[model samples]
Target: MHHFFSMMFSLLAIIGHVSGQPAKGGSERNIDRPYRSELTVSNGMYWGSWGYKSMCPIGRYAAGFSLKVESPVGRDDDTALNGIRLHCIDRSTGSSDSYDYTTIESDVGSWGVWTDIKWCYSGYLTAFQLKVESSQGNGDDTAANNIKFTCTGGYYLQGDGTNWGKWGNWSPTCMGKGICGIKTRIEAPQGKGDDTTLNDVRMFCCD
Candidate 1:
């Protein structure tokens, strides 16, 4: 009987030890969760553009980019987009110089749903801006009606050009230039319908 009691005590002690302490290694309490933002429109079939612009003191730096767009599935009569194209332009040049051009297609499984777009900068760029556009049938290119941009990683310079500061930490640098930022533009073709309404937009910075 004493041995049986000792075993029960041991089991209880084990249970107490397990419950007394906080979870170890943090336990993935917050990981890989979806981030969200939103854009709204009163018109049903028209195209609208909205975004923010800021000047980052850090001019010459490389950074990562991303964007999430939640768009309602087009009806049977409406023509759906075949793909989305992203353009990174150097605004300082005034010559439409571009750093990167990426296309996200519906088949890539990143569109129609809450689609995410990501890219990395290969060289130092100053005064950078992004443009997202959509394409339909052959010879039909339409700018995204609802778009969002996210800066997930990289260095951003703070302050003005002469008094620049480097923002090494990952933070949302919306519009203009910096770490995490987004600029959205919407364009509707003549016959598609009215302006497109966006359900949501989300941007995030990663560690």
Candidate 2:
């Protein structure tokens, strides 16, 4: 009888411990997403490099991102990259988690400042979209064209770009579940006639 009681106590203790801890696998991730600033420009038609502008190694959903453009001649609107927005949902329920922008730049010809990083409403960032344009005359110009998102269940949202290329369709699924983190790829800036473009964005899986 004593041994039976001890076993019951142990089981209860284990259950309590499990319940006190965070639930993994399909649950929300509690990781940090850091932002980085970068610039890329091209001098000729299509000559530049693509690398990370910002990255968060820990597993976290891509709530959203802020874009920064450099234009030697004009403002943010006159740059090649315009702005970006998010389209996401609750990871567990799959319900729409829409977000509204409050600090959008007014001028369409010049990117004033780095717009605020927009995030998801209910769940981790699960998907995204982009807005881009062709490089202006002969000026050192650059823009962040696309972005990605990671979820809890290994699911992801990804996209890419080409010189003056139009926006593509959103990715169906990164892995299978939710978003974790993101890495922004960029093109290096060149002298005048820079035609830089954000090539692609990749998502990282959580541990």
The numbered model that scores best in TM-score is: 2
TM-score of each: 0.25, 0.42
User: Which stretches of candidate 1 lie above 4 Å from their native place?
Assistant: 1-46, 54-62, 70-117, 124-142, 145-182, 186-193, 197-207
Task: Write the residue-wise lDDT of candidate 2 on 28-85 in tens digits.
Answer: 3233443222212231223234332222323333444445433333332223443232
- How many angstroms is residue 116 displaced in model 2 relative to the true structure, after the best TM-score fit? 1.3
Q: What are the runs in model 2 whose C-alpha is more than 4 Å off?
A: 1-47, 53-59, 70-78, 82-112, 132-165, 205-207
Question: Which lDDT tens digits does candidate 1 get at residues 1-207?
Answer: 113343355346435533552122122112222223222222222244332321111222123232333233333222222122222322344312234321111111112322243334332222232222333334323233332223324433221111111212222343333222222333322234432222112232211
Q: Cα lDDT of model 1 overall?
A: 0.27
Query: What does the lDDT read for residue 56 in candidate 2?
Result: 30
lDDT of each: 0.27, 0.36
